[model samples]
Target: MEPVNDIAQLVVNGLMSGAILAVPAIAFSLIFAVLQVSNFSVAAHIALGAYAAYVVNTVLGLPIVAAVAIAFVAAGVVGVASDHLALKPLRRHGPITVAIASMALNLVLENMLRFGFGNTVQALNIPVYRDWVLGGLHIAPQQFYNFLIAAAVMVALFCLLAFTSIGKAMRAVADNPVLADIKGIDPEFISRLAVFIGMGLAGIGGVLIALDAAIEPTVGFRVILPIFAAAVLGGLGNVAGAVAGALLVGVAEELSLLVLPVAYRSAIGFFAIIIALLFFPRGILGKR
Candidate 1:
């Protein structure tokens, strides 16, 4: 392929990957906005979701939709349960305390997954399709479908946030918890709900990644850097910024292949973090 064709294909591939990454990045930022914690345990929830879906999809031979539902529910349940048991008591101490506890919780959950599933790679039971070539650009059907699904989820999320009372309450809490509390909104309830939704989205993100790549205990960890990069690049607590950040990070990572070795792909995430911190402290779409 010509250089132009190569660049076009890279951009398309980047968009596909960016769509998947955005789901979890939004989860991260959404949680941060309301809870003011990093919640690194999100990585474990991603792997947990992938495993849940894998059991239903491969072992029980269920439909992908069923698996996705199970994945969301399982991960959401674990997320809230863990938050309550481990991090909740520490909240009054400080966000940093909770963050550290969350990292410990992350390690515990990931290790639990390792104990249960072992260190083996598993792939989803989806049919493979050849890439479609158009004007010298190749597009994978699975990736394209995943991108559409991601877009739909984002739209539904926007609608929920815009039109639903629960969403409005959530926004209120994110903006000013004290004010929301004064207005009769339940902070504890909102916190639990945010954790559930945020971790559930992370689970969906796991499914998306596993659709094309192998699923394993470390699957989520492998992408945590990029996910964090996306969130930080967009503005840590801004949901909309996550989507934009993900696209830019994805495209930047893919384009790096032109100059850097394939093994150095993950370096883009680090680079993005530095650039975001140095140049755009509030992120590209973040509020000034």
Candidate 2:
């Protein structure tokens, strides 16, 4: 019974963590589906956003809310810049070239952070949002807030894709870029929007981590693999799939603590991915 209770607590923790993971996974799938290239620098972009927030809060003595806002805007701008400066120039070079460029840029950003921030790990020191007791669960305020925010964002994104003109245009571009170009959809502009949104998602994800705990300069480096796995499992370009995959991975990872040492908790994701690939190569929802 005690072990079972511990498993339950772990599941709660996983859900909390997975809620945050959904943001990046969704962004990854969004870009991969629409642009046909993995934004390998997603981790860097998110880290930069968190660092920007940290700077604003620490150096400028701004509130956490204000710092997050600034980070959000800055991250979006960086995403747009990536499309314009790197992906755009190589649009004719195919996704392989774009992915390579993204990876190169990621390296540049990671090194830049190391040079600027040094090797110290820093905590944001934001006050925890709230604490609530519901049923037998001890729920942190941030968990509820994050879950609500994630759900709202997902719903809003879904509506945007389902009912808006920009959404339709983006869909057209994703489906057939040449046709979209011939139809005057401006694939570059659409792609820029996707990149910006994707980066924004990554940025907010970082903020969530900062809000939840301490952040290190190299933190985002650890985020990429799991996020990609979640995204792939969710189905490429499928937002719903991303969210579902995140939840599943989070729960499984958390529950694994029942038998596995806590030290190897992070390794669970890798093991799960391997098992998932072997059994369901198309992932939980199938590739989009």
Whole-model lDDT per candidate: 0.91, 0.79
Model 1, TM vs. native? 0.97
RMSD of each: 1.2, 2.4
| Clash statistics: count for each candidate | 0, 2
Q: Which structure among the candidates has the greatest TM-score?
A: 1
- Model 1, 1-288: lDDT tens per residue? 599889998999999999999999999999998898888888889999899989999989998888888888899999999999999999989999998898899899999999998988888898999998888789999999989878987888788888999999999999899999999999889989999999999998888888889899988888888999999999988999999999999999999999999999999999999999999999988873
Candidate 2 Cα outliers beyond 4 Å, as residue runs: 1-4, 129-131
Model 2: C-alpha RMSD to truth? 2.4
User: Which digits, one per residue and each the tens of the lDDT, describe model 2 over residues 1-288?
Assistant: 766667777788788888888987888888887788877888887788788888888778898778767877788898888667767788689888988898888888778888989878887756666578665667898777777766766787788878999988988887788999999999878988888878887887787777776777667778887788787677667778888888888887788777788888788678757866788676788654
Give the winner by lDDT.
Answer: 1
CA lDDT of 27 in candidate 2?
83
User: TM per model?
Assistant: 0.97, 0.89
